[model samples]
Target: MYIGLGIVLIVLGAILAFALNIDIPGVGDDTLGYILMAAGVLAIILSFVATRRRPAGYTTTRESQVDPATGSRVDHTDIDPR
Candidate 1:
């Protein structure tokens, strides 16, 4: 989600910085555009880092038992780690 948002921000910023010709009183269009572009790049990089550090969804485990009365084997399976 953040990656998509970052791409949108970068595209908007590029339009504002280079394609537009409007001039405001206190704020510069080019400056704001550059800031937005920088923010977008940062967002993308952070998103990548966060995704890389996350763990997997589930854990698997197996167990075996002996049925004393019938002298038979049994098995068990567990999905979660904890």
Candidate 2:
């Protein structure tokens, strides 16, 4: 998701820097565009780093047993972190 957002920001920045000619009161279009592009690159890099640091999978367990006194069956389920 962050990667996609970064790509979008980069595209928008490129359009602003190269295609648009409108001027802002306090900021330059090209300058803002370059800033946005840099931020986008940063976001994408961070996303990749975060993904690499995350666990690959979770552990799931299921158990079943017969209660001798009650003559009934019990079921249990659990999920464990990687």
Candidate 3:
């Protein structure tokens, strides 16, 4: 999925950016290397944001909560939506 591709691109970019310090040809100079690294990092971050899941009817609470739509209570301690 997108997550996998993001991880791959990030890792590959890091490798390419550093070039293993082996001195490879056609890899460009330090400026281009840094740009590539920045672009890759940005891409990965965007991909993560794009692929994140947001559940519907979701509510944020640290304690017992009331379901907004159902008007029911969700007791965290009881594990029962009563």
Candidate 4:
């Protein structure tokens, strides 16, 4: 959803900069279009970064966790009952 919006903003900015040949009443040729385009691209990139993609260094290791009730090892394994 946000990615689509970013694409739209980026495309709109590009069009305004290169294709759109319309001049505002009190705005110069180089207005906020470039800023908008940059913002759009940044937003897209941020959305991608904000995804649920974990890095490579993430692991299920617990070598530094300390128990409060008792000084024991934390067993994270699963067991089955018959």
Writing each residue's lDDT as its tens digit, candidate 4 over 22-56 gives: 87888744465786788899989888887746444
What are the clash counts of all predictions, listed in order?
Answer: 0, 0, 0, 0
Residue by residue across 1-82, what tens digits does model 1's lDDT show?
Answer: 6999899889988988999978878999999889889889988999999988877687889999999999899999999843
lDDT of each: 0.89, 0.92, 0.62, 0.72
Q: Model 3 misses residue 56 by how many Å?
A: 8.6
- lDDT of each residue in 5-51, candidate 2, tens digit only: 89998998998899998789899999988998998999999999999
Model 4: residues >4 Å from true position, as ranges?
52-82
Ranking by lDDT: 2, 1, 4, 3
lDDT of 3 at 22: 48
Question: How many clashes would you count in candidate 3?
Answer: 0
Model 4: per-residue Cα lDDT at residue 31: 65
Return the clash pairs for model 1, or none.
none
Of 1 and 3, the candidate ranking higher by lDDT:
1
Question: Candidates' TM-scores?
Answer: 0.68, 0.69, 0.37, 0.55
User: lDDT winner among the candidates?
Assistant: 2
- Name the regions of candidate 1 deviating beyond 4 angstroms: 59-82
For model 3, where is the 10-residue window of minimal lDDT? 53-62
- Give candidate 3's TM-score: 0.37
